[model samples]
Target: MQTASFVGFIRTLFYILAFYYIFKFLAKLFLPFLLKKVVQKAETKFQQQQQYRPDNSWNKTTTEQEVFYKPPTSQNRSSTKKVGDYVDYEEID
Candidate 1:
C-alpha cells in the first residue's frame, strides 16, 4: 500500500497555481485581439446585410395623422356590493 506524501501534494499545488497565473496572463494578452477581430467581423456582416436590404421609403408617409383614445366611463351608483366576507383569526403561542 502507498501513502500520500506532503512533498507531492505541495508540488501539485505549486503546478496548479503556476498554470493558473500563466493562463491568466496569456488571456489578458490575447483576449482583446480576439474580441476586436470578432467585433470587426460582426460589423462587416451587419454592413453587408444592410446593403442587401431594401430601403424603407414605403413606410414613410407624406401626411401626419392625429390619434385619439377615449376610455370607458362607469356609471355612478348609490349601493355598494360586497365580493367576499372578511375572516378574523387569532394566533396561538
Candidate 2:
C-alpha cells in the first residue's frame, strides 16, 4: 500500500512537469501570433475612429471669375518697393 501511494505521487508530479513543459513550449510558439492579433485589433479600432473627421476642409471655395496680373517692367521695378524697406508701427506713433 505504501508503494502504491508513492507511485501515485510520482505520477502526479510527472503530470505536473509534463504540463508545465507543454505550456512553456506553447507560449514560445504562439506568443508572436498573439501579439500580432492584439496589434491588428488596436489598428482596426484606430481606423474606425478616423471616420469622425471629414477628408475635405469645410472653408474650401473656388472662384469662377477670370483674373490677370501684369508683369513688372524694368522702369516700374526701379520705382517700386525694395526688400529692405520696412515700416514700423511704433515709429509712426
Candidate 3:
C-alpha cells in the first residue's frame, strides 16, 4: 500500500508539472495576439483624438455618438431577405 501511494503521488506531481508547462506554452502563443489587439486599439483611439479636434475651430457637432449605426431604411430592409442578417440585439455601446 505504501509503494502504491508513493507511485500515485509521483504521477500526480508529473501531471501538475505537465499542466504548468502546457499553460506557459499556450500563454506564449496567445500573448502576441493579445498585444496586437491592444496596440491596434491604441492606434485607433489616437487617430480619433487627432481627427476630432475641438480646439481647431471646427463647426462640427461634437456630441459624440459612441456607436454610429445606420438604421435600415425601407429600401434597405426590402433588399435584405435573410432571417438573421440585420438584427441588432446588443446596445450600441
Q: Who wins the lDDT comparison? A: 1
**What is the TM-score ranking, best to worst?**
1, 2, 3
Give the TM-score comparing model 1 with the true structure, all chains together: 0.65
For model 3, residues 13-46, the per-residue Cα lDDT tens digits are: 9999999999999999999999999999999999
Clashes of 3: 0
Evaluation by lDDT, superior candidate among 1 and 2 = 1
- Candidate 1: deviation at residue 76, Å? 5.2
Angstrom error at residue 71, model 2: 52
Colliding pairs, model 2: none
Ranking by lDDT: 1, 3, 2
What TM-score would every model get versus the actual structure?
Answer: 0.65, 0.50, 0.46
Instruction: Judge candidate 2 against the unseen true structure and give its global Cα lDDT, from 0 to 1.
Output: 0.83
**For candidate 2, lDDT tens digit of each residue in 43-82?**
9998787756576455558569878988976663464656
For candidate 2, the 10 contiguous residues with the lowest summed lDDT are 73-82
Cα deviation of 56 in candidate 1 (Å)? Answer: 3.9
Q: What residue runs in model 3 are displaced by over 4 Å at the alpha carbon? A: 1-4, 56-93
